[model samples]
Target: MRVVSLHSPAKVSGISTAGARLSRLPPPHEPWTPLLIGRALTDEIVRDTPLHDAPGLALCAWPADMSPVGQVLLVRERLRELGARVVIPNDLYHGFVAAALDHHRGVRVGAWLHAEHHDGDELFERCAPISDAWRCVSERGLARALRVGAGLDIPPAGEICPACVEVPPACAAPSVDGPLRLVYAGRLEKHVKRVMDLALLADELDARGVSFTLWVAGDGPARLDLARAMDTHIRAGRVSLLGPVAQHDMPALLTSADTLVLVSLSEGMPTTVMEAFACGRIACVTAGCGGAVPLIEHSGVGVVVPTGDMRAMAAHLARFAADR
Candidate 1:
């Protein structure tokens, strides 16, 4: 049998590399294939398209951003074309698979969870109907998968895939300085990311006579508000708003600062924290945010403060900054 896996080829170089690696494997008894489709799946789709040389089952990473519904439709159609079953990387895909199964009954759909998180239950409840099997990356993730399946009112029947930690190559250490080098990166928006706390913390530092240089690395709806809060610093060059740096530049950007801070109210295992850990930098993150609690405790990599507690967060930043 030939297996085919599908995902977007744009904006996810990591996945593309992994897909290319997985695609070269000889067809297993239960074949698998990786297909990069949808918008921007290739640099020049008309000229250079990477095609699978064999046949097999189709696995998916669930690229449902724009035209999410259409992607599901296409997957369903392709399954019919190959007379093969559908496989998914996570419960996020279960929802899409459920929708596809609603339109095309008798199609086999399965799940392969990459991590264990509290959101497992929610995902299964929303998309476990077409799921005929389950898979996970670790024993913990498998336990979560079992719980998720049970919560979906389904019996357990899944496998565990080996887990791989994404560690970065060894790099030079970050520079420590007297003036606290506070940095905040990621989306800049009050309604969604609520990253305004970075600016407020900078203002508090100014008020408390603590010298610091705040680096803001993105632009969003909250930029004006953050700018207004530190108008003087913005003009004096103490606070720099370098809008939208590339992902590859993140290591250099983070290593330049003494402490990496994120005040986001919501997230899902933010890669920022991982990136910080890989960079060997400490982080000041929001407590009970997404699933960072374990990482914070296990790695001794950083601190976790209550969401929107500017005073407490500022205090922690002060200590961390002073230590550096």
Candidate 2:
């Protein structure tokens, strides 16, 4: 069956990366087409082109400036033209559109839970009546979905589809005598990502005299602010911003670091952490990083500190630096 994965346009984000990978699946799996909405057709990134190197997986975008009814109508028309049998909406707006069109147009609607947020809960609740299926990025998300389903008297049928990355051949581990190499690869957003907290962590580490280097990758609206916040560290060569690294280059970037750091205010499951693991690196994440907390605790491969505890994070880094 032809499936359409609907999401917003993001240059370097988990949703965009996952959508691009889904679109590249070889035969035997259902073919997926990624459609980016809520952006203007004239936007430079909205062009109808294959996303990255994914063959036949053209990226499509639609404008969001239209009226709600008009947006729904346009989506319906486009889906009909694309002959989409299954519609997987990754965001709330598109989820509503798919929910509205599911029964009316005989298309199967699947709600995608990529994060643990009120918006995700609201989408599940609103679309449960008509949603044919649901998938979540982490076990926490799946459990939440099940809880919601139980409350609504719906059957628990959500699937856990965690984010993935290709594991390359293991590279030689970095020298233990050198400074601890830490990296953060994700959108540099302040709200959910808590990037400003990362700045504070940098300050804590510097104040503690920890021998470490932090490489921050990716870009977002808060990039300028984060840069300003880390100005001292950046000038001191302790922090480097490698803005918006390409997907293909991620494995090397991850392998170069000894530990991956994520101090997000929230997450469903971070692909960056998975990529770091794939590259044989440990992680040091905050409790607010969602599913990663338990994974790290149980697996004993990483460290987890309470959310916003920059001093604790710095303490751990200092220990790693001194012990290594």
- Candidate closest to the true structure, highest TM-score: 2
TM-score of 1: 0.64
Q: How many backbone clashes does candidate 1 have?
A: 15
Please give, for residues 140-243, the per-residue lDDT of candidate 1 as tens digits: 55555566666455546565553222355765676576678868876677844577777677777777677788788766567788878778888877799887
> What TM-score would you give candidate 2 relative to the actual structure?
0.92
For model 2, residues 77-141, the per-residue Cα lDDT tens digits are 77777788888877646545644565666788876778787767877776766677777888888
Give the Cα error of residue 49 in candidate 2, in Å: 12
TM-score to true structure, per model = 0.64, 0.92
Backbone clashes under 3 angstroms, per model: 15, 0
